[model samples]
Target: MLESLLDGIFNGISIGSVLLLAALGLAIVFGLMGVINMAHGELMMLGAYTTFVVQNGFKALGAPWSDFYIFFALIAAFIVTALVGLLLERGVVRYLYGRPLETLLATWGVSLILQQFIRSVSWQFAAGVGVFCLLFFGALWLISRRPDFEQIRGKAIAIMLPLSGAISLVVSNLLGQTYKFAVTLPWFGTQGVDVTAPKWLRGGLPLGGYQLPYTRVFIIALTILCLFAVFWFLNRTVWGLRIRAVTQNRSMSACLGIPTQKVDALTFAIGSGLAGVAGCAVSLLGSVSSNTGQSYIVDTFMVVVIGGVGKLVGSIVAAATIGIISYVVGSNALAPLVEFSPFLQGLLEFFATASMAKVFVFALIVIFLQFRPAGLFPQKGRTVDA
Candidate 1:
């Protein structure tokens, strides 16, 4: 009985961590821009693909390097996804600002395009894209940092985009000649690829006479670190303050000399980059495919909505609440009490399964929102409140 309780709790926290990690960026992006970025999930898919590319690169290097690929994978994923986010924001999202419906339709199209794009391309092409986005976004970031260079930013970008693309193509083709990653699937294909864990992180840890997987523990720790980092950035840094200011009152922030557009672009990039990090973490647990992000997209959105848009504390509590409830309902947590009664036990058996658990969880969330539509932590700025 005690073991069941402990196990369920551990699973709940780990599951919640994954949900929270994925939702963090979505929360920020949705809250700040009011743009329903359907491509947010696709950005996550890009991160996973980036990690896979890094993994293959490490494999080509061989031995010790291959064993420690995850470190590079995480960084690469963030950079690649961040750059993609920047491009998406500058190209599509910015134009559609304050128009949520159009943003939704546009991003949804982008998401489908991204998924289909990956599905049709070779890993090498994908790798080249990852490289191109990284270099290009880095160049753009440098340009953005220099206020005096704003006049030439357009020409600079026009030159850099093609230059970076050419360089990435050459680089990926050169690397592809040495070693190649191949996939085969006749119709729908096989399951996705899996990421191997390094030596220190493999195996399980014993806690309260129960075994806790190291991956889960690492994920939980990563979630906490990410949450702390976000909080610190939003509270402690200059850019963070600018982001908060812009999110609250875009026009007011702009009037105050804040570069609201740049702030929006950077904030969107940060959120997308976090999704990339979540992808890296997730790859350690199971297979990753184009559809990987689709699985969590809806749930993460729910997390953001339930916690209140743009509310980190709300996200934390909401994710934890949903995670624990999902786990408990799925497991035989109520079986102990109903064991003596066959009728109740039979009824519990019907609902205490993974599929049924989700139904109950969703229903509960629906009911909760009925009572508090603005969520646990509603926005309180003059612009929002008004």
Candidate 2:
């Protein structure tokens, strides 16, 4: 039972990491730009699709590049979505910025357009072995051709985001070595384990009756490292300072020589990049799909709202809280009731079959909003600023 509980906790943390990545972007766009991006979820969908494409590309090319495709997809999704986001901001969102209602309606329309486009292009292409090699090169060229960052602080944050993830991996490896921890996957029906720890740390330490997986150790360490990096970026960096500035007062920052337009574009890009990384992480756990982002949209936004607007700290708190609550409620509280209650069980069984847990959670957020109008940690005295 204790082992099962530990497994659940591990799963919850992994899931929360993905939510944190998705919400990080939404929080920045919504809080900083004061634009409620209804299509934010679709941007995430694009990222997941990018992953799917890259994975398929590897298979089609017969390249030994499956594992590396995750890295490529992260870069590709960020570039594609960031460009899309910039165009949306410049062409549509910018004009409707001050008009909140129109912005909402227009973006909702944009979302539908994107969804239909994805649906229309759902057919698979089976070209010759190396047909897409040039296309991949072209995509890389397009990404690199983006204009240089005008703001120093913006450039700094752009560099730091990925660096933070790398640093986390390193720290996780180091800690694994000191503790003699390793991650192993069971192979076939063999008694021996498949040691999958980083090259530097290959041995395992026994705990109780079972050997703790080194992957779990790495995950825990990485999670802590990501948490630290997030805190530091928000609190210690100059770009972080600028991000906070714009979130509070865009016009004022523009007047103070902040290159408000550039800031907006970069902020959107950084947020989108974070989402791309999250999608890559998701691919590790399950099959990637065109609609993967749709599954997490409601829950991720709830974390943003429940964490309060424009506050990174709030996001962290909200993510952890919602992750624990949802996992506990969804798996333990609801599962047994549906299993044992006959009539009630049948009703819940039907709902469960339809994946209504997502809808139920969305409804709960709406109900909660009615009681706390500004959300859990709303920015006080600044409601009228946007």
Instruction: Give candidate 2's error at residue 384 in angstroms.
Output: 7.4
The alpha-carbon lDDT assigned to residue 99 of candidate 2 equals 88
Weakest lDDT window of 10 consecutive positions for candidate 2:
186-195
Best-fitting candidate, scored by lDDT = 1
What stretches of model 1 exceed 4 Å from their correct place? 123-191, 381-386
**Candidate 2: residue 276 lDDT (0-100):** 58
Clashing pairs in model 1?
Answer: none
* Each model's Cα RMSD: 5.9, 14.6
RMSD (Cα, Å) of candidate 2?
14.6
- The lDDT per prediction is 0.85, 0.61
Off by over 4 Å in 2: 60-64, 122-236, 333-371
